[model samples]
Target: MVGQLQIEVLGELNVRRDGQLLPLPQSKKTRALLGYLAVVGRPQRREHLCKLFWEVPDDPRASLRWSLYKIRQITNTHDVDRLTADHHSVLLIPQAIDLDFTNVASLRPGDLDTLDVEVLESLAAAFRGEFLEGLRLPRCPTFEAWRLYHRDLVLRSRIEILRRLVSRLWEYPERARFYAHAIESLRGDAASIDLRSEAPDASVSGSSRDVARGNASATANRAGQPGSELADASAEPKAGPTVGTPQARSQAIRFCRASDRVRVAYALCGRGPAIVRAAHWMSHLQYDWESPVWRHWIDALSEEMMLIRYDERGNGLSDWDVADFSFAAMVTDLESVVDAAGLERFTLLGVSQSCAVSVAYAVRHPERLSGLILYGGFVQGWRKRSPHDVATHEAMTTLIREGWGNSNPVFRHLFTTMFIPGASQEQMGWFDELQRITVSPDNACRLHEAFGEMDVSDLLSQVAVPTLVLHARRDAAVPFGSGREFATGIPGARFVDLDSANHILLGNEPAFETFIREVGRFVAETVQR
Candidate 1:
């Protein structure tokens, strides 16, 4: 206790130094900045800090410097530098502090169940109340948004622990019932207070298929719903969805709750006409940010326009232990991400399986779209391609399940080659590693099984958006005819044929360059200025 400083942020802003509570700075912004730096516990750029806490026409840099000085009241000591700020970035390195909430916040989605009971209970106890309680600055919208999101995160962690305790403490019937009641109470509050608008419905929705028939109209109604009211920008950022400020170049990965309450992770980059890339099988937002195979695609797209992308429900950075991996639910996920990203009207980009989903979305919510782009997509999935294709699809599913998570790269190589036969050794290795880390083998097999059954041929003719279709000539994963079918089937679609065998175009190849140019030109033409 003599050498340690205990800072509690799960509830209000409370810092104790050597068994004596310290008074916080008078300025709410300073106190807010202190909490933000402590929670992130990472070196944040001076530019980012300026944008996050202060605004223009008021000398934001000077205000930031003032705030740093105020924060030093608690952090400054003769010991090591707890609060480090320089020309480039600001960092808070607590010499001795409690990081239980930060540790829980950093956890991967659905990993709470994997943790030990004692640990969950310990983390659960940290939540005395809301995060940074009473710390809300309406003028500083970005900081307010961050605070609200972190609060929802605490809400989620609390509920998950209660639910886990209810299920695990079977022998302790009274204790189990207490936890069960706690979950209901939390859900009840979430429903009334709207901690997350999706929590109540997701509790009863179970699987996406079970509710698709009942919620189809509901999905349509919610698809075009607008984002929350933030003081700045068109859309406000949240725990589930974070949109970038116009001048903020860095990608801030955030979460958006799908209709089923599944936390779908999304990020926004660049500034301009928005482009929403619907989640596909191998999408990992954070992982693909610097990936060799996908980085070029992200970089090219972001430079041209604001690129909005998310990991689909069951894979990537999204919650893995999802109840539904159905085609209908994927449509819901797309709508959720779009609303969270806060675009009034924007181009939608669909690749592979998402192409079908985009078709369905275009048909359902044509008013929300400026244009639709389908790349390497099919009118019918592998199995539904024809009656004779069923056997082959099933066989591939079985093969992938058996060898998916194995150390041997043979299975991965076989699959990766089909998608990117033209890939270099480095690209191929990236693809292989992507499969192992982003998705579990069981979920992969389930998605494979579901994708094969997808039949959106009925929706293709119904698409009303300005449409563009691009496909490789000899893609081993999907047939060249599949691409031709989309162009022919859609009412008014333009098709571009790239002279490559790979389903996924490699960055070094000419086809990728053509792909970028065409997309940029089409988006520029279609997006409303």
Candidate 2:
């Protein structure tokens, strides 16, 4: 314990002697200074450190010297000079010093159990309050950016770890402690559906390759990965535990055009008027098949009705060899799935981007729709890319193209901010892993391209079905304006704006539950199903 010094400073700042916790002196500035320097985990300019800790100083340099002195007096370390100095550069010694920042930074996907106890202790300690609370540094943009960057990284990493644990324990109701803690970390409403009982036979397929490797012929039939070999192998039984009875067989209905093997995917549950629900990007029907989040929502709609959920063409169990993804292609896919499912008329629930598709479907075939529900929807097509936005998108695509594997952090942040706003580090990590496994940059780009050109405003007026448009006031991705626009376009479309910002119904339980309840009642009263 004495030979190797482990200093954990990320969320909360704590110094330990060996494996045992050591009391750090109680001073706000000192702790802030130490945490800031430690977060750099590298050398920093003395000027930067001083500007970060001290706000208004008559002599800022001298103020830095005084703060350094106080920090040294409390920590009893010569490294104070290394973390701060006037002339020379400041450095935090990497070797022989153990800290949670190091551990959390070192974490990768698929290695949760191997995380050392010291790292956990350090994370628990550093995460006390908001970063550098009660203090605002002078106009140093570099310091401000660095402070935010480090804080976000730590928060994101911690959340990623917890999210993985939450996913793994999802089916184990016995691990309620882990689930409860995970939910608390997520800031998600505790009233969300439970994964265990609702999705008893559901399984989570880790990745597309995992999904592909198990069934090469099937993957080849779906065009396989991004590029595939056409050599046909004999069809083997599908992967996973097989249900002996044909009634229990969960088969995907394929929607394909003549001379085109690429198919749209749909899953059917229950019997009666078909209800179609659109999931966001990065869906795995095999995995979601088991997710209580999906099951509960679907089950609610499926009662006295036939419910259909489909995987968009480029991902999930759907055929992936399409040259491009467009609203037209997506619409065709939807039509195909409906055709295969043999649904003549149905209700539609469009979530997130899929809301556009739902609108398109209703507009195109108003005669076939009994009712339409739009949740967290947007109306703008990404085709109107300003120069800046186009540049941003290109840069994003480049970054994603550069790396999209389990270790990629860019996709992690992108996925987190898009879907799980304020998600924990663990959750982000798990999603990053899952996202990588589901679709590739090529496929994602195709989908993005489709979203870009998607203009459903014209179709709104043509919608013949009784439509309900629901959105969250605080949705960060698509502003509430999009929802308003969607409702305004569709004749007599009812618009409901909720108080929450969770884009997906899975995260917003009470609101979603109420939404489904209302929709059920609406369908009962409005539709002749």
Candidate 3:
């Protein structure tokens, strides 16, 4: 049996036996040594430990040994054992102690509301101050760097988890206010470190008390880095499980055979004709909801169908292998999501570049599909060789590769203009963050490469299902001509060209209403067949 122990280090460090507080060793250095190792929990050599605490005299080797002896004596734990050394190499075995940090790492997204609420509460209460109190050593640059690295990682993880919890606010409305406050508090003044001038003003203010208690839920959400509520709410949860698994609310999963495969990650709501949504490059099943773009999309779709969307294999919650963004691989990923959702026949809705996949699915599986809908999409590449296009693609790819967060303002403006058009200040921030969450530069380049090669003209002619193609007249990324061509190629395909521009429709009433009217007509008319 694995023995159990409790160690809390929020404001002050406290160690407990089974349920009672235990007396710690006298030496300050010794307590600090044990506390640091327990929190880090990774195997380390003796030389490394000595370097971390430079206060330990010049002879780090002897000082390391002395610290080890003291740690064992104070804790009465046999888990700390010395490894065989080569030259200055050293290692410590921390297999015995059950640290709270490890427990925090184990929380998953699918846990019941009760358990998830408790875990979040406990973790929020743990990270009280810096890792160690006041053990300063001018010579321990390595320690300082390591400490900062771990501290940031912990903070990032907490933010991500809390974000997921908030996204599933539908599941536990009661826990929302508490988690929101905790998330905002933990974030401190991170928003003050602005990376762009024109940032969003989204905030998170909905709690059970707010909803049930009649308080106002905040209006817009922004990207997290620049003090946006959308950013805080949409941050991706750190690693674990795929789609409804305990650790993750949504996961990108792959199910393949030979050359055919499908990658899909989904957030499910209701059950009926499943709306298989093909998303533009970046998406987190959970994070996207924080953005108004996704909110409007889901609100419209879920009224009639269960929405199934996933990041393309190289984007969002999927694997990060850049070379796997080929069309063939993407089709396979979609198949996996369909199979996972266990839907036999359903509607397929393609958005932005994903229209390519929806068209392919219709041509290949017309018999298995209930209907098809395309919105703000294109059949051909935007412009063959405009220098502006090339520069935009290259610049965005470079920014993603260099680092996607708080770094590139040009890329943000370009994408915001393309996706959300005249979005509110908060709305633009949400779009910027959603794009960032989509994929890295390497992956984005691969997606762009795949998109460049897609020519679905031959396949469009083969689609026989009831199809509705909706395109914005002023779509910056995809021209109206492509939507027209798509409708022309498919026999009996109905086309509706809206006066609005922005690719994803951005909550425009007239455009959205037009889309719903056309799509609803198609779905209702076709289902009778």
Winner on lDDT between 1 and 3 is 1
Per-residue lDDT of 140 in model 3 = 48
* Candidate 1 local Cα displacement, residue 77, angstroms: 42
> Which regions of candidate 3 are displaced past 4 Å?
1-263, 382-406
How do all the candidates rank in terms of TM-score, highest first?
1, 3, 2
Model 1's alpha-carbon lDDT is 0.72
Instruction: Indicate the TM-score of model 2.
Output: 0.51
Question: Per-residue lDDT tens digits of candidate 1, residues 409-476?
Answer: 57888889889988886577668767865787899998998888788877888888899899988888
Q: Model 1 Cα displacement at 198 (Å)?
A: 11
TM-score of each: 0.60, 0.51, 0.53
Better of 1 and 3 by TM-score: 1
Error of 2 at 328 (Å): 1.3
Better of 2 and 3 by lDDT: 3
User: Clashes in model 1: which pairs?
Assistant: 239-255, 240-255, 240-256, 241-255
User: Pairing residues by index, what is the TM-score of model 3?
Assistant: 0.53
